[model samples]
Structures are given as C-alpha cells and as structure tokens.
Target: MPAFQSTFDALIQSWKLRLQDAEAHETKLPARMETCIRVCEESLLELRQWVMEHSFPCRECEIYFFKQVKPVIKARYIYYQKIHRLHTGYFNGSGLLEKERLEKELRELAQYFTDNDQFFSYYRNGYTHHDELFFVRGQYDWKICPEVNHFDDLFSTSFDGKLAELMAYELLMKYVDGMLNPSCKLTEPATVTPSRSVAVSRLQCTASVTDIVELGYALHAKGFFNDGKASIRDVMTFLSTMLQKDLHYYSRLFFQIQERKSNVTKYLDELKAGLTRYIDQLDEQDQLK
Candidate 1:
C-alpha cells in the first residue's frame, strides 16, 4: 500500500507542480486552463488504469478509496472542465451581462443542491450508514441512484461521481463569488515569528515526504502526541512545518497505506530493524572496548 500510495502521491504532486508552473509562466488564462484540463484528464486516465489492474483488499478499503480518495481527484477534473466552459463564455466588456450569467449559474447550482439535499446532508454530516450501497462497487440502488450517462460497475460507484459533482459545484460557487466580488477572496496572512523560523531551519527531514507522512500517521495512530489528545491534522501540521514539507493530502495517502496487500507497516518495520541494527553496532563497539 505504501508503494502504490507513494507513486500516486508523486504523480499528483508532479501534475500540481506543473500546473503551478503553468500558472506562473503562462499569461493567457485559456492556455493555463488548457494545461489544467489536460493534466486532470491524464490523471484520471492513470487512476482508471490502476483501478482496472488492482483488486482492493476488502470492501471497506474500496469504499474509502471511491468515497474519499477518488472523488477528490475527480472533483478537480470536474472543476477545471466546468471552469473552462464558464470562462470560454465570459463576457469581458459587459460587467452587468457577465454578472447576470454568473448569477443564473449560481441559481442552477443551488437547484442541484436542493435536488440532492438528502444525500448532501448525509455527506456533509459525515454519516456512513449507507456506505455499502453508495460507495461499494456493484451495489447500485436504481431507486435512489442519480442519472449517470456512463456507469462502469468495475471502477465507479453509484454516488461517487455525484459526490465529485457536489465538490465541483462548491469550487464553482467560490470562483463565481470571487468573480462577482473580487474583494471577497481571502488571502493567507504572511507572518512568521523569528523564534519559529529558527526552530524550523534547525530541523530537516532527509526522508521522502511519503516516508514522513507514514511516520506521522503511525505516530498519530499510536497516540504518541499529547497522549492522543492531538488530532491527526495537528500532528501533520507540526511535522510539515518542522520538516518543511507540505502534507496537505496525508489522509488520501494514508488511505492507500491502509489498502496495502501485505506488510502494511512497511515503514514502521524498517524503522524497528534500523534501530535494532544500531543497537547491535553499539554492543560490538562495547565488546571492542
């Protein structure tokens, strides 16, 4: 699981870096959007191929992948596609006309939410009573399932795509609101204390981010921090700042770790072996002395 997750995280990170670079260098909005759309399509294709080749270890892992992991990636694809369509029709000179169009689209999005209020509430509230039917493969309930043009029983669930759609709509709403009121967009505050800066500079992680993420999760699972009072998010944030690596998608990566076929604690096992070997070396030195 760690191997596959590390590969997947690397793939996502590479594309995200490319997208960031494109945004920085490309002045044209359409060209940048094209790059984003192409990258998303490529990612989805690779994910589909992986799904086709691998069998999940169990139903729960499958549910987590489809419900939590896959939707995130799919939501990005849907967002870019929708944004591309919206921008292609954007009116540059007529502010009033564009505002009207955006408002109409907003209303439509609201209507979609109203239509799926029950499922949206279920998702928003973190209810998992219907996970088996909504996320598991081939558990589609026709009476409740949304209309999908193309359904792949092997790779898709009844509600995963809809879940992606809901997430995409959220992004769209924020974007459209930004367009409507540019000042409403929030910006991250740039402030760093000198003491904190010194602390971060002194600490460094030589291992890969995936390795660090694995270690962070293990620590969290074992209640190593603050006697289990610390949340995973808190732990990952502390590690990220200390190690100078972004662990934004640690949960998705951890999901992949959970789905490992064998040796699920690969990193933890390696850590134990390395510590034991170091102790053995110390004993040999003592014998030499």
Candidate 2:
C-alpha cells in the first residue's frame, strides 16, 4: 500500500509538471509580437472595408486573397515554428530526454503545428475556401456566420471573424515579442523593399486587388452594382485610406500583392518600400498630433 501510494503520487506530480511546462513554454509574447498583431489588425481593417463594401449577394469575395492571405498566414506559421523550435530545443538541451522523449516531442509539435503540416496551411484553406465550409441558412433575416465546423473558430477567442483575425494579430505580437523581451525596442525590421522609387514604379506597373475589390464592394454597399472602374491607382488610393486605418496590414498586404507579380522580388521590394514610407508618414503625423 505504501509503494502504491508513492507511485500514484509520482504520477500526479508528473502530470502536474507536464502541464506546468506546457504553460510555461509559451513565455510572455515579445515586442515584435505587437508588430505582428498590428499587421493582422490592418489586414482585418482592409477586410472589413471590403466586406462592408461587398456585403452579401455580390460576386467578388476579396481582391487580395491569393495575394495577401498566404503571407499573413505564413507570418503566423513562423511564430508557431519559433515556439516549436523553442520547446524542442529546451527538451533536447535539458539532457534528461530519453527514448520515451519521442512521444513528448511529437505531442508538443502537434500542439503547435498539428500533424506536421504548417499552421498557415490550415489558414490558407480557411480564409480562401471559406465557401466550402460555410453557407447562408434560415428562412428570414439570414446571417453569414460561419458553419458550425469552420476551423476559423480555432483562431478566435472573441468569436467574431474580425476579432479572430485580430486574435491572430495579438498572438503574433505575443509570439514574436516573446522573443524580443527584456529589450524594450525592436525599432528596425527587415523591409520588404528598400527604395520608394522602386515601390512607386511597381505600383504603377501592377494593380492592387485592394483597389478593384474596394470598387466592387463600394458598388455593392451603395446599391451601385455596375460602376466599372479598372484603375489600379484608384485601388491604391483606396488602399491608402485603409493604410491610414492600419499600417501593419497595409505593409503585409503590400508584400503579398508584390508576391503575386512576375518579378516578385522587385515588386515586393517596391511595395515594401512604399508601405514603409507610408507608415513612416503616418507615424510622424501621430507624433505631431
């Protein structure tokens, strides 16, 4: 009876230790984490404008889905990957790991990435293939809430799609900032582009989906379903107003748009530069005010 009691006590202690480790492993999200969150919020701001403009019974879903969603999703993946690597490194570095450790590593990785596929892959499908998962139902005053099984709720603590996207933003801030804690400022980030001229050149060369989608949505929202304007500059200007709304999203989406171009690196550089400049201007205005 004494031996059994001791074994039970050890098992409880082990379980408690594992739980503590899992919770402790998260660390307190870092400063760059906030940067990531800001980007996510900006994306949603653009998204909300697009949604409010388009609303329902309209054709175009969004302008930048293929262009932007992947990058935003991938940024989250990078954060999760960092966490996975951190946990794995901690276990390996601890030197007490054993043959039984494979299960623990596998379980921890699963918790972060889930089944060896990157978390972004799930988001890529979720954001773009939303129709495959949700539909408008009911007989009257029908709503556009996600289906009961849409994986989006996994990203949500607030249950609003906008809020879920925002959660991803906060998660990003916490994740990256966790890496940059104990140091207050992470003032410099690697820009997607280095020159303003390059950005404007590309901005002239290719059209942003934001412009087109906003035009479409504005038409939908205003009951003006056929005001056809294919001007990229117009979209860019609309995107500008949105940038005025969210700098982080504007910059990320700008990169995503560039990613879609044939000369992706060049375009990305320009777009990156353009957003960096745009955000700087806004930051300056805020400082002055």
Candidate 3:
C-alpha cells in the first residue's frame, strides 16, 4: 500500500509538471506530454502487477483502480481540453486571417477530447460503482465479458488502454503544434525568401531562460521594465508584444542576419549589436519624455 501510494503521488507530480510546462509555453511540452502519459500507464500497470502478485480480491482491486488510476487518466484528458481552449482563445484575433483554417483544425482537435471525455464517463461510472452489472440499459454485453469476471479482466478490456494511449499521443501532437506555432497559417506555403519574412521555422525557435533574461535586460534599458528586476511574465509580455508588432516586419531580416553568421560568437555579437541599437533609441525616447 505504501508503494502504491508513492507511485500515485509521483504520477500526480508528473501531471502537474506537464501542465506547468504547457502554461509556461515551454518548447518541450510534447516531450513532457509523452512522459506524463507514460507515467500514468506505468503506474496503472504496476498496480495491476501488485494485485496479481498478492492475489487481491476483485472488489478490492476494483476499488483501488477506481480510487487511484482513474483520476490520473481523467486529469490528463482534462488538461488536454484546457490547453485546447487556451490555444483557441490566445490566437483568436492574431490578425493572421489565413490562420482561420488552422483555427478550424484546432476546433476539430478539441472535439476528439470531448468525445473521449464522454466515452470515459460512460465506462468509468459503469465499471467503478456497478461491478460489471451496470444499472444502465440495453448496452450489448461487452464481448470481453463472461458469465462472471474478475476486476482485472473487466478493467483490462473496458478501460481500453490502447485507445487511451492513442488518444494521448494524438492530443499531444496536435496540442504541441498548436501551442508552439499558433501564429502559423498552414494554408500558405512556408516562406523561403530571406527578405523581411517570418519563416515558419523561426516560430519553432523557443526562447531559453537565458534568452529571456537578456531580452528583458534590453527592454529594461529601454524603460519597459519599470522595476530593476524583470519577472518571467514581463519577459513573456514583451515578447508577445514584439511578435504582434515589430517582429512581424523584421523577422525576415533577423532570419537573414542569422543565416549570414556562421560562427556562433559572431552570431551572438551581431544579434546583440542590433538589439542594443534599438534599445538605445528607445532609451533616448524615454529620456526625452
């Protein structure tokens, strides 16, 4: 029981971290999503193993499954739904009209989770409380059921573990795509021209913590960060404003600058110079104010 409790705690922690990463707009969310689902699957499998090893009674095992495993899976599905809504709201008025098609795609992706939620509720209610003899009407006897069955067999088939796995995988893929590239318009061809273009590839480049700090410092110098210390939220807000305003125009120039510099140090130097010049101008304006 102690070991099972520990595993369940770890699973909850993993889910929390996964959602935290999503909230922070971390580039590695897809990876974290995989880890999150893997932890749930593993813990559930471990519970099954323990039940078999101890030869626990069917009712006890079912109670354990209901109390422990179901919560993790249910939470994951809810997280997916929340993220989908966040994506939709975040990009709703991004001014990239072409991205409306992608918005439609996102809605479709969200529907998948809605469907899964319905399926989960139906099976969970029946399997958890009723013990295979559901009160609900007229559902065909599940082919996997027998005249009588153990909790393990009932859960193994009715829980539909494979379906859950596939749903998680699909949700992760679409969620990652939507989160990381919300500004993207899939209907248009990706721009190859280096002149003042926002390449789809550039959207994939995530800002590291260090990058955020440096950018924040520059903005602070330009009088954007009123406090001496820049918080993560401030950095994110500045970046979002930049994307919505100036970056859209100069993104191609930035990309061209990156392409021209082969040496890492030179690249950093040139990038810093460009940012510094812009920051100085903003500082001058602030001083005049």
Candidate 4:
C-alpha cells in the first residue's frame, strides 16, 4: 500500500508538471489540450496496469484505490476529452453565433449535473455510506449505477465511473463559463494616424490572415517588440494596421492553427525557407562580384 501510494503520488506530480509546461508554452489551444489528454491517458494506464498486476492486502486499500485515486485520474481524462471536444467542435469565433453556441453547451453541461444531483450531492458532501458497494469489485448495484454500458467488472465499480463523470463535469462547467465570460479586459483597436493610414493603404498583406496571425504569434512568443511586454492583442493590432487587414479574430484563427494535424507552423516554416533562399542569392551575387 505504501509503495503504491508513493508511486501514484509521483505519477500525479509528473503529470501536473507536464500540464503546466504545456499551458505555459505558446502552443495552440488544441495542441495544448492534446498534450494534457495524452498525459492523463498515460498516467491512468500506468495506474490501471499496476492495479491489475497486484492484489491489495485488504479491502480498505482497494476502496482507497477506486474511490479516491482511480476516479480522480479518470476524471482528469474525461475533463480534457470534453474540453477538447468543445474547442474542436463548438467554438468557431467570438461572434454572436459562436457565443450562443458556447452558452448553449454550457447550459447542457449544467443540466447533466441537475439530472444527477443525488449522486453529485452524495459525492460532494463526502457521504460514504455506500463506499463498500460503490468501490469494491463484484458489489455493483445495477439500479443505482448511472452507467449501464461499458462495465469493467474486474477494475471498475458501479459508482466510480459516475463519480469520475461528476468531477469531470464540474471542471468542464467552470471552463465553459470562463470561455463565455472571460475575465481579461478587451483590447481596443489602435488608433491610426493619417500618415499611418496612407502607408497601410500603400502596403497590402498578400498572405492569408491565418498566416499573418501565425507570424504575429511567433513574434509575440519571441518577444520581438516592446521587450516582450506587448500583449498578443497589441501585436495583432499592429499587424492588422500594417497589413491593412482586419485581424480582430486572430485568436480564433490561431485556434484553427492548433487544430491542424500536420505542419502546424506552416507559414513560419515557409518564411524561414524563403529568407534562407533570399540570403543565399545575396551571398552568390557577392561572390560573383
């Protein structure tokens, strides 16, 4: 039991650190979510494999694994999966229609909690009268189990899956709420001067807004301007003015970049190759001279 607990603690700590790193990096939302989901899957698999290979010395330890440990790990997986679905499926842009869709999803998630209020209350209030039946193998009560399908009699109990869903839904609600009502102050568009307007008019962005947004994010990540103090919105606003393009939805476009399965930094890679070729031409001319 002590060894198992210690190993589980270490696994969770490692998983958390990886998640933090993924979040801290300037990756796309879907990419970060993929990393988070992978980490959770790996951790859960490790725990499941260990439990299957070993027998618990007593019922108390078995209950601890199911009621406390396994459900928490499974909850994390469920949470990330649901979040990934939302970002990939529901979210489009910050337009009225998108906001409406997100709000509707949020309400649906809330309704799930309302539907399962009894189990939620039981779990949240720390009532453990049914721990033996809920956490122990071969003690499942079909009448009370929220899930009827995909039962794993060897490793899962009737209520643990429900518990995991409850926890995951709680986290999902908070995330969806934050999406609908972000706390960050909106950045207004930069005021354009007459001279700046003329210059912007003279120069046009031939590339797609998606490409420009990719470049803007790269520059922001590299701290190319204002000693890295500039927010992404600021950089985007400047790029929009310079290119005479509306980049108000750069964040949404960036999310699209994240969803790409291959060549996520397509534009950035192209830029690098193009610059190298230009330099090579200049070097060849200098050698000829």
Clashing pairs in 1: none
- Compose the digit string of candidate 3's lDDT tens values, residues 179-260: 4343321123345676535563365445543344345445645655435354333444456554442221122222233345
Better of 1 and 2 by TM-score: 1
Candidates' lDDT values, in order?
0.76, 0.39, 0.47, 0.78
Candidate no. 3 TM-score: 0.32
Q: What total of clashing residue pairs does each candidate reach?
A: 0, 14, 1, 0
Candidate 4 root-mean-square deviation in Å? 20.8
| Preferred candidate (lDDT higher): 1 or 4 | 4
- Candidate 4 per-residue lDDT over residues 1-289, each given as its tens digit: 7865675787778878887897899378778888888888888788878878888878878888888898888898889888787777865556232777776776677567667767777897898888888888888666777762247877788788888888887777767656754443334658999998787678756999889999999998998867777767677777887678887545546666776899999999999999999999999999999
Per-residue lDDT of model 2, residues 1-289, tens digit only: 3332352344335434543554466454443344444444454455445444543332222213322332344345344445454445555555533435443433333343322133235454465444322222121111533232233322221113332333344454443323322233222334556585476456431345444333333443453412443222233334444334322222233334334646534544565789999999999999999
TM-score of 2: 0.24
Comparing 3 with 4 on lDDT, the higher-scoring candidate is: 4
Error of 2 at 114 (Å): 6.1
**By summed lDDT, which 10 consecutive residues of candidate 4 come out lowest?**
180-189
Error of 1 at 274 (Å): 69
Q: Which regions of candidate 3 are displaced past 4 Å?
A: 1-27, 57-61, 64-102, 109-140, 143-155, 160-289
Of 2 and 3, the candidate ahead on lDDT is 3
